[model samples]
Target: MPLLDASRDLIAAAARRVMARCDELARVSAAQSGIERVYLSPEHARVNRLAAEWMREVGMTTRQDAAGNQLGRVGDPASAALMLGSHLDTVPDAGRYDGIVGVLMALEVVRLLRDATLPFAIEVVAFSDEEGTRFGKALLGSSAVAGAWDPGWWSLTDAEGTSLREAFLEFGLDPGRIGEAARQPDELVGYLEAHIEQGPELDERGESLAVVSSIASARRFQLIVEGEARHAGGTPYDRRRDALLGASEAALAVERICRAEHHIIGTVGQLEAYPGAVNVVPGEARLSLDLRGEFDGARDSVWSAISAELDAIMGRRGLRWTAREVHSAPAVFCAPLLQDAVREGIRSTVATTEDPAVIFSRAGHDGMAIGAVTGVGMLFLRNPDGISHHPDESVSEGDVARGIQSLAETVLQLAADR
Candidate 1:
């Protein structure tokens, strides 16, 4: 748990490199107007080339894996590799930090230690896709590495109706060779990811960085309410069975119930009312519910309550309702020793009266999938105003410096353990 032995100058240099690289990658967007580097897109290839070039400059051997993941390795291939880096993919108009920062930070870590190779190997992985923006399934890159790639995903299509397999082929990668991306059990020491906090927690606590305890379990649901579509002017309020109105009540109940609980979040991210007509009442209303929590029990408990509330709401309005499960993922906890290494890394970078803050992420990460294969650890850098997935999302140079140092120190810390 002792502070990282690296000098301040090295940390500063690494920070500068990460900041410059982030700006450089921001320009390679799929959209000319804003950032939109989705999976298997041309922009994705452009960014990977840039990242791979930087990795090579830092004295690492680089390759673009079959899954389109850009990987850079330091030390002998025979050695057990400590996997570092984050996803390179982004949501449309995403902030410069989110996943890209982590990839750059990992490459910087290798650069900081260029003079002395660690006892084991270090690999920086620019995961091809984690946002799921194009294919609507997140962690596609990490899933392949974790040996969890679903063959069903091959048929998944983008907004343009192009299949995932077709996109892979067009991107100069063989979809049939995706299995080649999976890392064997003996190939890794562990996985470490350094990323922007994407929330106000660290900033609110007046800290630049913190260790993550767990990634939240999440569930997505589609709720639909059905009612008779009648003439709006003729159907009196008292006699009307309005599907939209019933759906609105259910949404409000979701917010109220979640707000009353601790660590549980429920959001209706999308909503639609059917039967397109200015005068006719909506015959059906459909809404998307995304619920997440630190624990599966808490998440499911809140979901069941929401479902019951929906039942009551529909019953009162004489509307028929149904709930469909869309997506579900269980929580992933950080390994205890990895948590200690990151905590010590934080300790090495800043002055803290209390213990270094540890947070449970409500937002998901590629770590969730990677954790299925090996131990995983995460370090979170502070983000101003907790903004992400937007052009205005920002992070400070000073925070980046601290984050780089913390991540480098974490590698050393874990190295000592082995």
Candidate 2:
């Protein structure tokens, strides 16, 4: 893609608009202080309406899909579309930019080329359930679009004990009609998403943007450790079998094993011990393990090592251990065509002599599901310190400005490719 004639001032103004819009959406959250917007909730409805209004402003037609994903399109509606945008749902206490920035930046891309003739139509989607904060199932919205929705998901309930089927009805949607949201493979030319880096790669490299090579393969498990409970005061150190202690050691083992490997990550996010009395040794303990890697083989290898270490720890403590797999997804690699488009897009906006940076995302995104139906590519903006999923997560206005231009350029590149 050739360098765009768009002036610095034009890009700056658009970036400011994106920032302001993010702040506006941040207020539409469930939490009293922090940000928390889940699927099929009132906040989801409000944000969808707001996105729809913005879509209309950009001369695009808008609608809410049967799966409750917000969508907008411009150009020839009868033709296949090159989809842009990302999820609108967020993790608990999520920062403002994680997914919200991508949706808004996509709108800006549309605004930049609303009048330009294209080979295909362009569509923006604000996926309703990417975080899985409510239903414990990620990519529900995108999975529906990919025609990969599982009937089993209907029975999944939220913390409030409301089933997904019930939530759909409450949100004025019919669960049976969700098939309407799925797009045939030919109906989409490709999907491109712009999002914050959600890591420190770009910021540390002093670059504003980079092309994502792939999203990490992931495996999540609930690990349980069991040991006999005994009187805390009466039991000797060698005689006591403490489940909590064994579970703690297992968590540390996960970190140790993963740390020794390249591009592997392990997190023990949640832990709980049974038998609440302080005087009593815990009889049972459970913990959540989130393991990710760039490749499935390496990821599985790390899991084996961690499991072996767990067995040794448990055996030494006279305990038993087991793990129940909760979720697993193979890595999704970006299509060569889309990746080239994004690479050229970033090159057009930068003055550096080096080629644009490329990274494999350790974090997951809607693309993981959308990739099943069509080619997918991503551009990531610099996130300061990569402090995501927290209130302090941040992105600079300057980076946002670069991101808008890069994305707009990427659309042009793809259009040229077609």
Q: Candidate 1: RMSD over Cα atoms?
A: 1.6
Give the winner by TM-score: 2
* Model 1 lDDT, full chain set: 0.89
- For residues 1-418, write the lDDT of model 2, one tens digit per residue: 3546677898899999999999999999999999999999999999999999999999999999999999999988689999999988999988999999999999998988876888999999999999899998888999999999999999999998999999999999999999999999999999999999989998899888999999999999999999988999999989989999999999899998999999999999999998968999999999999999999999999999999999899999999999999888999999999999999999988867899999999999999999999999999999989889999999999989999999989999888878
Residue-wise lDDT of candidate 1 within 138-194, one digit each (tens)?
A: 889999999888999999999999999999999999988999999877898899999
- Candidate 1 lands at a TM-score of 0.96
Q: Against the correct fold, how does model 2 do in TM-score?
A: 0.98
Error of 2 at 127 (Å): 0.6
Q: TM-score for each prediction?
A: 0.96, 0.98
